[model samples]
Target: MLKKLILIALFSCSAHALDSNIIEIMQYLQRDSDLIQRGFFLNKFDIVQEGIEKHKVDFNTLQKFNIDMFLDEKHINYSPIISSFLRNIKENRIALEKFLKDNDKIRAYEAFQQLDYNCMKCHALVRGW
Candidate 1:
């Protein structure tokens, strides 16, 4: 009984920690996304580039966390969906970077929009909304 209690306590603490880490990651992503949007609207590719770099760090941190923590019977298929969204986001970022390098605001804007759409779609899936 004591061993079971200790295990439960440990598991609860770890689960809480993981939840906090995920929340932190989401907050950072949102901030970076806002920065990128502002930079785009203001015609400041440099700011957009900074946001992109920050987002890369955020993604690295997120990947470090055990995503299996987010899985359950209801979300058994979540992993593949997450991978697909990550791939789409990566491709969109690459296109955005290329467009910015070429100083093609129009294409960059389109890429940004696509990125936003991908993010929203993923959120909706996760939240079941």
Candidate 2:
């Protein structure tokens, strides 16, 4: 009985950690995304008067980034769909980061478009549309 209760407590703690990680990712996705949209799409200077902030996501906490945070050396032999989804997310993030670094409006908007698509797909799979 004690062992079972301890295991349950450990699992609950892990779940809380996972939820916090997901929330942090969501915050980054929503925050910097708005910055990009305002700066690129609406051409708003007041919002990003100084300059755009770079993304601050730590990919390690993401469950999909299993085996390697760099997402290069280790590979998952999962189904093509899952593997492709992870790749798409990683690629989109890289593109978005590059566009942010360069401060290119057109490219930044395009990268945000692709990022939104991936986000929707991932969200639908994880929760719902």
Choose the strongest candidate by TM-score.
1
lDDT of 1 by residue, 1-129 (tens): 999999999999999889988999989988988989999889787899999899888977877876667777787678788778877987888898899889898998899788878888888888889
* Model 1, CA-based lDDT: 0.85
> Residue 5: error of model 2 in Å?
1.5
Would you list the clashing residue pairs of candidate 1? Answer: none
Give the runs in model 2 whose Cα sits over 4 Å from its true position. 42-83, 96-104
**TM-score of candidate 2 versus the correct structure, residues matched by position:** 0.61
Instruction: Please list the C-alpha lDDT of all candidates, in the order they appear.
Output: 0.85, 0.58
RMSD of candidates 1 onward, in order: 1.4, 6.3
* lDDT (C-alpha) at residue 66 in model 1: 66
- After superposing candidate 1, which stretches have Cα over 4 Å from the reference? none
Question: All candidates' TM-scores?
Answer: 0.91, 0.61
